[model samples]
Target: MPVTPSDIVKFIESRPGRPLSAREIAEGLRISPSQRKKFYRLLESLATEGLVAHLKGDRYSLPRKQNLVTGTISVHRDGYGFVSPREGQGPDVFVPARFLREVMHGDEVVVRVERGGRPGKPEGRLVRVEKRAHTTLVGLYEQGRKFGSVHPADPRLNQPIFVPAGQELGARGGEVVLVAIDAYPNEFRNAEGHIVQVLGDPSDPAVEILSIIHKHGLSHEFPDDVLAEADFLPEEVQPGDLEQREDLRDLPFVTIDGETAKDFDDAVCLRREEGGTSHLWVAIADVGHYVKEGSLLDQEAYLRGTSVYFPGQVIPMLPERLSNGICSLNPQVDRLTLVAEIVFDAKARRQSSRFYPAVIRSRARLTYTEVHEMVEKQLAETIERYVDLYPMLTEMLALSEGLTAMRRQRGSLDFDLPEAEIILGVRGEPENIIKAERTKAHRLIEEFMLAANEAVAFFLGQRDIPLLYRVHEPPDLAKLQAFQQFIAFFNYGLNLEAEGVDPRALQELLAQVEGKPEERTINQVLLRSMKQAFYAPDNVGHFGLAAEHYCHFTSPIRRYPDLQVHRVLRQAWRAGGLAEQERNRLADRLPEMGEHTSRTERRAMEAEREIVELKKCQFMAERVGEAFAGYITGVQPFGLFVELKEFFVEGLVHLTSLSDDFYTYEEDRHRLVGQYRRRIFQVGNEVEVLVQNVSVERREIDFTLVDLAAQQTTAQESPKGRRAQGKSKKR
Candidate 1:
């Protein structure tokens, strides 16, 4: 038999702690002369993937055997970076600034771990870059006497791209432009690139948002083939489309969403039975029916993975013809859907669930504000407007309340953190920033969706069907321990002797700090200590939700994983169960599908966050020198992050700006202390601050204390003041 990759790996393993050349490896396997070229290529490919390390003299060995590690490098704006291993579990290897001269952020590279480094963590130097993350970047073009350079919009990309005279594309000095890198940077030379697109002034709000879109590499426009396919789809559901779908047109179903929502993907109907049981029907648009597997539309949707929603714009996975037209569950229109019909007891505990295809005509489209007024406030005007649907709405409210109680009883975490809502002008400029409201009606819809998702996940998991689950693994022990230490400052404790702590323990701690002064700060820190939720093939369970089986089955119009779940459910339901062949096929592909969707979801979130910060900076630019009441939300070695009470905008108060006294950071206590005066700056400390500077391009806002002396006087009498004085006296 011909030699394979496994054969090569085995041969290399045989000679442990020794690097061997390709010729020797091939000779030991009795390779022919004709196979020499192919053999060398195979070895090179393995090295590129970090499976093997290529040392001097063209010899190869396993990466671990040579103290070499491979992974993507995430660079901080300060120039240092860390390499997270691609295929194993361990601490990330830290790479100092001097050792990162030849590599950029997000580049895949091999690192050689030094013998002596930071305690309990490995430090390394970049050996070779295996892959580059960016070939093109968006930046501000700065013209020089002889040539021009593009300063990257992303702060992690510290090096400037050198653009020669003729390659400037007629861009002005301060214009935002896109540049294609022809040569990457090294120790001896700067990166070289040519301007490709001039994207107007950076000060323009539209240009600022557009620059972020390009920086994240988000696909905003659909390809011609995908658009053509979307156009070919029917504008409305046809007669044949309802062949096997249950007709639920007479049901009083309604869609409750934001006033600005254009694409409605889910609708709900709840019925109260005589036996004190509730039957809930959640109907999700049947997007899988139109965007078949391997079709142009499906390919594009898979590539996008999830729709990216900006402040006033959205980059949808499918073309608008489908996302907002035929697939949207609009009121008074017959739309094809996949229904999750679940039965619940008086306590809102799920009794049984079934999935089926259906066709439904929604009775009305309601906004969250209206629903809140009708349900929570009991407004006569709002209830009179939807008089026919009020009884069902009341029943829905009861079911939602029961479900909320059940989840809370099971230790489901509700962070209840405030989010900023950016009010924009007609020209897309931010006019104001306010805290987003989360009313009972919002929770009602959220509870219904969560119930549907859990029901679907449990249904599929019981049958051992292959699908992607929304998994949130338990927090790392080290992180949990550190969190315990931090919360101890507030006289809070957790049982951390065991390997895994119960979710209810965390739930109780949150309850203890609910209305305390340090509530937001503690909540933020505990949230950071938990692991991020992601989609995976394995059923690891969701730690935050306290669910044994969980998956994304709602909102197929925006999320790809939900569409895949729908397809699998329909196939399995029609055939009574999935066959062995079908199961194997799905099992083989779901892992990769999960990974891609998770990555795209994170990318979209980052883009959304970046745009919001940019807009906040723009809004604050006009308010410089104005004082506002605020509180410190975060404390680090370098500075304090203060959030204004009026606008919900956060700005950094740098250490250098505190010229009155030199302060040292207390990492364990999360505070800053003065050397002589003994003033304390800690999390949750209220103060007055003035906006000093705003850089929209960098998405930064700088603040300074309005009156440091008065603040210090006020802090001198607080509980923290006593501790600071006691520590100073001890010193």
Candidate 2:
């Protein structure tokens, strides 16, 4: 029952001293979820009318209020910053440069709302800085006459940290150094720091990557205690290890992975059942068996969250001894595993599923290319090498197709976008940038893993267990509507309605636009509109996979959440329905754990992206004068960004380079049109460009527009003009 305005007022006033958040107010009013949007609007209206006080951090109280709002301040490189509210459904208040006297990015701050504005552009003034996100900054140290300055590795952290005389800590100019902040700047002076550690000169090829690693705060080397703990992990499965585990070493389980893959976390085997059904044995490496809870290894793994992968480097969550040796499901070696044994019906729906500890010796370690050759191309050498497993491989192909069809039919949105694959030399220099290839071999393993993950999540969720779920929330309504309007320009029918988004609708749109000229553009737009999937204690389901139940059940060697899930499941297996004590403890802590893992996961991603981007920038730096044909991917008032056809790099072509005519930006149309010549440059337009510059510091490549069309037109016109001039000269 929705409470009346009078009832809401009385409840709010009842808590006289303390403030009530929007969630609490809604709960008190018995407001259901469906009316949440409207309820928020009502609260906003009340606040605007001065009937209710919306105070600091969006908490509501009596009519008397303070203008201060508390949140995290994200300072833009241009000096301005935005403070996102800490407590309610409100806009991020923008703080001007003058008010941000000593603020840096990621500071917990209190802001005074000067006035109300649009949700996207609210105005505010900084009142106080509650907490500083970082005490140390990593960057290049430059020695000045009076003092040294630190150029931060992160470009967004634009302001240089000043180092006073004799505080350089023997760090020379152009060297990457870690600086510890001693003082934060005010309107009177610049922020000051002292050099703590010299990481080497930025001119060194390796130092660039080193700077990126430190900037993201990722730990690469394991601690001595953690490494010592890993030594206790068995090199091979012993009799004691398999005491309570089912012995399945005789089964022909095989590991399928890339040629360069060192750690094998999962292995699989299939058996055909009666009535056109199949049984899948997905044996995952038993990391929890070796990495006991509260141990040094477990602590380190949790801190890392997930392994970070670069072009030719991998920072493993666990030590190499565990990730690649004992815990890896190596062929011909007995490995302990937690298996999700599943039986699927003819329609590829899981009929029954069970999980238990097991020991398995993988028959062979197979590469994707080899599998593709054996299964798809029917290569003689491949068949002869694995002649005994040939029959099982063929059956696995059929099963994989069925599972793929089942997922697709359920409205799973699979984006087949091309991802960059950097080929590095022995010395780690990028030799070439190519799109990562996906074969049937990749899908075969993917389908099996997806099934096992879904099975485990469904089982745990049904039991009312508190566990981490890989959740993807639905897209924001405003972004979806904006996307719909943009796609309409291509005559594509993408009518996002008030009923909210569904995976099915997005899936249908992608299928319809496949192989079209606008395929990549539409795919990029739709992907941007979707929310990022992350770990959560509560299950809202995975939207992209169209899965009501989904979690990371495999790859414990690299991901912490998978290891956590394994630990929880193993305990439940022994104790049976976790006691109220354990359950309550998990319920209290899982949310925080989920948030930490998610942040670490994002940290790893940013580090990887930064490294790859730096390599791409370096590659483009050598070809500054070359010309290339590419397509316009983005358009803005200042310039258009074009993605190269062969190189796969995107660079900006500024509007000032349009020599034929002055171009004016059309914001709503997403295009730049010439004022006099009427020439147009729009997203998806093909054009030739000359590489203008590449800035390693900014991690940007620049291109200048090449007027091939105008050049050809001029060439044809010149001959006619020359012919008339010749006639006049002959007369």
Candidate 3:
């Protein structure tokens, strides 16, 4: 039976001192959800009549000045926390450390929100911990008298744990270990816990990186079910399956990727047509062939959302048997693929496209370096390795060049940011970190893949099919305005005209500042101004690529969205495709899938960055008190962030260490300045600094300012004198 206004009033009156939110009350009474607005109106009517007392924070309790709300406790590193009420009803109630009921970060808790001294701002005391965010945590294990304690790696957790010596789980001092929170102690001093597993010593090369994975709750190993499912996959393709796909065996297609890349998911072939036209075919691995929906492999892939790529290792979403074997487009192997066959005019305007399943035989496997060298210099030895692919490679280069021109004409923003490559030694220690330069070969493959992605998105959109699209929305007007203001320091102003702007303007700005010292900082700011690209069922279009439509149609083995796209395309092409029943079923599912994939991708990115940061800390562990030239990337109340010119590693110059001045934070200006001396530290300023200290536990690099007099003396001297001053001093 539907709830009535009278019933709501009666229910509220029956329970004394029972505080409930309007939405919560509606949910409990089984009212028509859309009628929640009217339900709230009824509650307001009752409140106006003085039957119930409305709390200052819009919470309706009984006549008393008490209310109960359920919210998640977000603990700060300083120990104080805020309980964020559900549905944004109440202002975040600040909970002091003493008032906290042993709740940690991300724990959902029931809180009593009542007036303290302030009228608008209310105080909350946690009544109960409704849900613990996590059961396992990564931390350091310390031995004590007859017992051991675990200090959590992620400092956001407000509580520490104590484990008996018998349940220490063999964790050694200074070693990172996984601990299970068995019980929440009555006192906040110590939490009851037991060690589940000891990760490894922090000094170990990859231990910090692995611990970051555990800390972020990402899986490092494939589940047993997924592995078992992978083991059953066929090593070789059967002739019957090959018969169903288009025979592209005769085409000279090639796979181009990093030299270290083992799983080749995309292969391409291109040719010039009459009247300056071009024909291109992108063959992507048909992963959905083996990993059926509801299968263990599929379930695991969906959960992972994407492959996790570390410096020297990759935790693949699918097991190696599939990712590195059958689905991989290895040279000379006949593999099943969903190919996007496109026809374009010489100017690189897409004429038409058709999606089909094909049996492709890659004639050669080419590395990015070899392909790049062959394209630019006609490296004979490299060309001979794939003689048949030379013509196709030439065609791909030409078509890709033309396609990129078209995209640029359409306002595509191309920022050539240098990527870091870590070289690991035999024992997994990082030998060196170098920037990986991009070349034409890489661009050619990238452009080809982008075209295919756009084509797939367009094709799917034409059918009005719901699928995961790589959507990049236009930048927020306010953020763009702020970015324009920031660039004025470099005398570079953004022309966000009355007609508004697009990605091309940003690209032009990047080009204008290419070789300048401010390029990196400006590029970062421009990127920040733009909205993030995410997976979505709605096709709002890609702002960065300047495409009306875009989707991840390649790299299915690594990305779950690509795999999902492949599945949708396959279902559409086979059996007269995407039946009404199937479409209806996916209508509600696609949005949720997009949201999950976007969230998981963000978490994976955070985990990846944290590992890299730890490695960087490890690399510079022995280089304290060393000096290097660096550009200021960020400035805050605490310190100035300096990005090293050579290594691209960022470190902080704490305000306390800048002894020449009393620094104050200017939020609007994005800088810190000294009040008395007026010394300025702003983004994009180049300065020399010493690596004063490296904090392994905090993953921080602290730097002190270089003496101005010494810097001027070094500059006044010749190159030889500067070289002498550059001599290394041991820590």
Candidate 4:
């Protein structure tokens, strides 16, 4: 048979991250010189097919595979690394520290697959650095007479950059400074750098956030041209711009979000139609109207991809003039909006939907708390304040219930996972960390937003127009089977088929486990098993939401994909259809745009999660001696991970703390069983622990189990990492 795409792909994949020359490939595939041109073209096609990566010197390698992987490294403080693949498949490959001498965390690299330390798994051998995640890093400078060394704030970047005394840039020994790389590490040479920016003293509490900003290369300031364009934007909705747009200013629309939220990009209202029907209006700020495509604002927004929100700080994508001023649907202000008018019949089934540009005056700016108080708890003051909108709000709640029921019936999974909500003090210190509950009011807006998003996505999809789609493919079969085995410990088995798992099966499993002590663990495992939702040119149904067509149509101010969709919607709306020429142009660009937006979105999420995690560590650092009641969230061979009920802070309890007997880990039960006493520490078991040690460097806290039966001791044992201590007797 002639050389097929699969044959070429498999051959390249066998040597993942290793480039093979076309001539070599031709020889390996038995292609003569006369047939070489067609094979060469075929190799080129493979290079651009998103499967194989084309390297310099006319070489190629597989971009995605279990063996030879291509992706970014996530280095742990322990010196080991995990490679998160670009293709978003498989568990991250483990790279031992011995192979990590040349690469830092987040560096893009190809890894050659090797036999794993564990059975039925694979390990990775570092291949080559395709791209560097950063050329600069933020670290503390230690000045010396002859030279200065900077230790990276990110412990994962263990290599200290050697900075010459003259290159210290006047930074003191204890000061934090940003260092520009003079050289990347190699087998023979260590990395070197020169100080480019001298940050303030490490003692500054605000420096923590600054360190994260610098570490992630996030900018708080906009370019001069972008700023100038933002400044020149009209401060209010102008009359001339109102042409050919619906006037919804007369309607009673309201903005409902958190009290601390500054940007109200979406305002919602509802009207009861005859025959037990409901007409819902979700008006999102028409950012596209002000920030035209290819404009400075558009370029900046696309670059940012999405806003990064740290506690008490927000690095917005658009300038405040646009994101918070005109584009924000502040109460009593007339803001231009793209409206999604959806009609749901008695059974809460979407009957008809329409999209158009409109202008609306937000009558009231409510919050999730206030709405929850009035609707669910029936708070007196809240009801009296928005008395006219009270009836409408209750009706909206009823409609939300109906919509939620329909969604639940369609096998949509609702993971009742709590979020870590950091409460900041006046001085930017984390005063408290609590679990943020997802309330009915939050769900109310969510149901409406989902309806609108789906309607818009379905609209464009049916037209065969090229637009970025939010897709979540099904879980990998191995992961699904693992999860099924895990839940079997709780006397539950998933109704999964041999072909693969279904969303409904997972949904049914969650429903079955709800309210049980194992609910949290099950939810976490299920979430981990599922693929992440991302923006892509391809349409794969969103598994989490169980929706056939879904795109991010809300929050255009913060997200780039939503803005791009708005622009595409306008083009298609104006032309009555996408012109063939325009469609082809978009087809060429949409795939790349999807990839870029997805990457940036993940970057923002990582930055946000890191900051929150760091703050949690800092918060725990202050209360080292305090004892708190908690539950065993995770159990490994070395320790039990516990989440304190009062503070929502999770810490590790080393195996040494269980002084009564030695313990061995049982992977199937996710627990440690004592060898002699047969005592067990497993997931979901409530336990009390004393905060022993906290390491802001590792972003972790150490806890010791409080032997409530034994006499309380003032002595606190230090928290040791899994591999930090000597071997256990059981081991």
Candidate 5:
């Protein structure tokens, strides 16, 4: 057998506490001279993975034997950091500011774990830096007398990059620029870098969004070769493409999406069968048909991973020629697609499912608002406008209701947190901010997509095919215990002594807290208590969805994992089943694919969220000194985070601005209490506040109490507090 990582690991483990050199390891394993280079590379790979450690004198040993732990360091804005070990389930090792003087955030490092530290947590000091996270960073350029420096846009970096006089790239102060690092920071000096790209003025909205795009390392533009490949694709589906495709042009397939949506990836059609059965056809755009594996387009799509959507703009995964042109299932167009034909019984229980390539002509393109009016509001004008699609729309509604009931019965947790919707003007400035509404029509489409995804996942899983599964493992026990303690303050409870907490119990808890004052707070806390869902080759099942098998089979145009699923399904269907060699190839490739796509997905989310927060700050900047009724959504040592009642915006009220009395943070109660007056400000409490300050560059908003004097007087007079004992502490 070839020299595998496992073989090397076994050899190392055989001689406990004895480190071996590369030559010694190769000689002991009988590795031929031809395999020497491969062996060295594999050994280095093992070191990077934290499987082994490189000691002084070029010897290798298991990390644990040398009291070393390897992991990435994530630094807080406050100068403290934590190292999450690459191969353990233990708590992260906390590193103080003094020990992190030589390393930047997101660097891979080996640390020497010590016994004493914070209670119940490990502490560590950096042994060495193994890898750097960034060679290029986006920042605001600043000019000094001798040389220029760039202030990193990401707060976690927290260090200024020095630029020599000649390397400014003609960038003036206040301009946003991308810097390439020439020398990393050490205990003695700051990092040094040269400006490569001068992005425009920071005050401009376009430049502001671009800054975030570059900060997150997102690709905003496609390469020439990828674009050339996309442009070569047929603008319309060719006749030869229909050779084994089932033609569903006669069916009344209509796509329902948002009014502003341009790329429609899925269309739905429902047909009633005898004996109270229903046939559902979900056709997803056939992106895999044009972007062959290992092609330029496919490589680009794999790199981009998923489309990043900001307000009024999108950084799409594929070029527009494919994403918006041929691959999109546009209305009244002959589009190629991969269809999931599912048969369901009267109770919405899936009876059977089949997958195949198909051609579909969407009868009409309808918005969620239009569908809502026709089905829920029963509006005559809207129903009359698309009368041909109205019947199918109603049938879809009925089927979706059945599916929703089935999913709920099986214990899926549904969160009702309102998302902020930013309405922008023609110039891309925020016109208004409001809560996004989720009408029945939205849930109708959501239910159909969920059903289709589950069906496809079950089909692929049964045949033991290798694909990326949307896996959500069970929550960590410690987190759940802490959550149980938190909910106890509101008199809500969950049983934890059981082997595993069922999703149904959590669902029931949500139902109990519905419409209560602490509903959103508890919901948000429980969500935080759960582990994040990620794409993986192994099937752990999705906990939030209460699914036994689930994967992303819809939205291939925007998501690379969905496109991967489509390719695997099509290949298996054509070949009657994947051959052993093909299966092995896919099995080897899928783990890395899962890791890359998951990472890109997180990067996209962070970019999208940062832009939205920036826009919110800008919107609030125009309303300084304005008072708004809000609720205290979070309480911390430094401040209270309050969300506005009228607008979906959150701002911080620093404790220093309270002004009336000295306040103390009560962690267990999740509240801030006044020491002298006995006044309490807790999560879910209503408060009125004025917009004190807004920093667009920092993406921060500050708030102050509107009437602190009156509130203090009321607190002193209330039966819950003792009479005023002394003068209040003044800021």
Candidate 6:
């Protein structure tokens, strides 16, 4: 007999508030004995159709509330978890520790929501494990006489997995190993696994970097086939290919970049036209000419979103033959390129533009220092001092500054944050850290690339073409409001109305903090308050660039998103038709691509951070009890993070080290105030600290107070208090 919707409803209604077992429900409904065994199957279908709810203990019931969603598990080290839906529009759900089952982080699980008012917070439990996100984890091997276990190094992986004796990891007590999860954790037990690769001892510095690469799941090398394919490519450019592209063989252009840069992707040429207009030509490497779509090279490039650059090494997405030799716009060499020719009006507005494939001949390659000196000193010294093409270089700088001013007038958010460069000595050992200052040479190249990228995006959109744009949506209103409250202490407040906030406001705020001590601290906070950029087929526009249409059409040698954009642009140009069906297909696929590429980019960034942190640890390994001046970078209930001015190394000054009095953290005012002495540890305050200890094993640096007298004298310089929008009253 066929079961009707009313029949399923009636069966579920019978359970009411009780946890009815599948068998019990069948018996209560007086289902036939032959069909009794098939009763649970019907209940499963009913659960899928939202007709009934599946609770713990193999029980069934009617759903009692709204916003009750089932999603996968993503656990955190802090014992809390977030549940992102298997399908639909609900803000990511949160589950507290008490309700979590044996499910590990990144596990696909069904969750039952608990009561909550805020849409951001969702409490739930693990009803079932649908799938496992990663079956492998990097960890350390440990033994307990007869039994053995793999202690995971990834903090998010909370529980350890068991290993059998026969599959002995060949790892000593402290050795790192990669463990493969054979079976997942259930209600009352940990997962089962066996060690796959037994990485050497943890004390070795090389092992530390290797572990970082593995922990983040980043590839360190290309495949054999990929290398073979690269090796077979032509060593030099042929004359035949040049015939097809526009001959810019006589045009004098220059390649400007860092002294260490090998893969030159762009070359610029600038000229002043009649009517005081500027003629700008930006020639970029046309990688699509050789690396066709759906090829092995393309697949590999897509997987690796961007090149991974470490201290002394780089894992490039494209082969060296192409990235460093053939496609590179080296001086005195002919290279195939995609050129953007634009005529800028006297006002620096892009009046007319065209894109075409071309072969470019570069006359000279100039380093940033060489060009900067030429512009700064007006080429006073000998021209034979490796300073070439001073006139052309000066013209390029003028055009770049003009374009920049035009962008600023159009509401571009120009956030200039400090970037640190690690100074490495012999055999890859850290010597010091220096801040990387941006010169006019750097800005000149940047502004030109931005102009070209914007033009490509507009050209594609005009054709109604499908493209993966780098989009940055507006900030979360609630988070922005929270940031607003904190800024009010400075007699300042952000425009909370969604439509009122503009890039100009942020630029104005940044301009105000130019040389102030609070510049770094406040800039860091403002950066965190903005939304992140990601790859997507839909054009939400980039908030940071202030561009209505913006995509990465440059840097195909490094970024995978740019390569994809390159392929789309080429197809649109050749076919002169919009791929509507392909757009629909990619639209379905792009969201997932966006999520993955974003996650990988984050992973790579984290890997870079870990490498730098380890180097910092290594630098301070032997400096215990040394005193140096530093600025307070962070403040908390437990301690303060102070960054030294001399070395740029940051270490913690725990609350216990402050022997004067008990201190409490004030979150809103961004300070730590002593209960008895009234001493304050505020952000941007300078103080002297002694390096107390350095733990290479833990990758942590610790510090203690050095000049208590100076601290007391400087304590009187604290800023006066305002109405304090986000501050709390003293307890």
All candidates: TM-score: 0.94, 0.88, 0.83, 0.90, 0.94, 0.85
lDDT tens digits, residues 1-731, model 3? 55665687667666555577776677767768787788788787766543454555566665434466666788887888888876545567888888764777888776777556477677877666656888888888889978888899887775678898799988887789999988875653667889988989877767777788888788779878789889998998888887668999998888999989999999998888779888899999999998898898999999999988888888888899999999999999899999999999978899999999999999888899998878877999988987777877887888888988888777898876776777778878767767777899999999989989999999988888879999998886767888988888678878886545867777778779998877877888788887879999988989899888899989899899999898888888776568888888888898999989998898899888777777777777778868888889887788889988888688988887776667799876778888998988887788998888897777788876678535555664978766766763321
lDDT of 1 by residue, 95-183 (tens): 99999988888999888898548687899888888899998999999999999999999999998999999999999999999999999
What lDDT score is found at residue 76 in candidate 5?
A: 88
lDDT of 5 by residue, 1-731 (tens): 79899999999988895889999999999999998999999999999888988877889988887778898899987788999888573678899889888888999998888775768788888888889999999999999999999999988898899999999999999999999999999989999999999998987989998899989999999999889888889999899999999999999899999988989999999999888899999999999999899999999999999999999998999999888899989988899999999999999899998999999999888999999999999999999999887887887888899998888788899887878999998888899999998999999999999999999999999999999999999988888889988889888889886566888889989999998878888889999998888899999999999999999999899999999999999988999889999999999999999999999999999999999999999999999989999999888899999999888999999998887889999887888899999889998889999998999878899999889735765777876544333333331
| Candidate closer to the true structure by TM-score (higher is better), 2 or 4 | 4
- Give per-residue lDDT, candidate 4, residue 543: 80
Q: Rank the candidates by TM-score, best first.
A: 1, 5, 4, 2, 6, 3
Q: What are the candidates' C-alpha RMSDs?
A: 5.4, 8.1, 7.3, 5.3, 4.1, 7.7
TM-score of 4: 0.90
Give per-residue CA lDDT, model 6, range 1-731, as digits (tens): 65555776687676566667877777777788887657668788766645566766888776543234555667887777988875453667778876665778877566677666376665666566655777777788888688678877766777788887867557777788888889887767778888888877776666777778887788777888877777777777777777557888788888888877888888989888888788889888888876777777777777877787777767787888888988789999888888888888887799988888898888887788777777765567734564557667777788889988888776677776766678887667788877776888888889999999999888888877877788888767776777777666555656757663777676667777767776677777777988888888889998878898998887988887777777777677677765678778766876777777777777788788778888888889868868889999877789999999988788999888786788888888878999988999987888899888997756789998786534643553444232232243542
Better of 2 and 4 by lDDT: 4
> Which pairs of residues clash in candidate 5, taking residues 3 or more apart in a chain or in different chains?
none
Q: Relative to the unseen true structure, what is the C-alpha lDDT of residue 182 in candidate 2, on a scale of 0 to 100?
A: 94
Checking candidate 1 for backbone clashes, the offending pairs are: none
Residue-level lDDT of model 4, residues 60-119, one tens digit each, is: 876544356777799998898998876654567889999989998888787877877677
Q: Which whole-number lDDT from 0 to 100 does residue 556 have in model 3?
A: 90
**What local lDDT score does residue 173 receive in model 6, on the 0 to 100 scale?**
76
Assess each prediction's global lDDT (C-alpha) against the native: 0.91, 0.86, 0.82, 0.87, 0.91, 0.77
What does candidate 1 score on TM? 0.94
Please tell me which model should have the higher TM-score, number 5 or number 6.
5
Clashes of 2: 0
Model 5 spans with C-alpha error above 4 angstroms: 1-4, 7-38, 56-59, 709-731
Residue 446 Cα positional deviation in candidate 5, in Å, after optimal superposition: 0.7
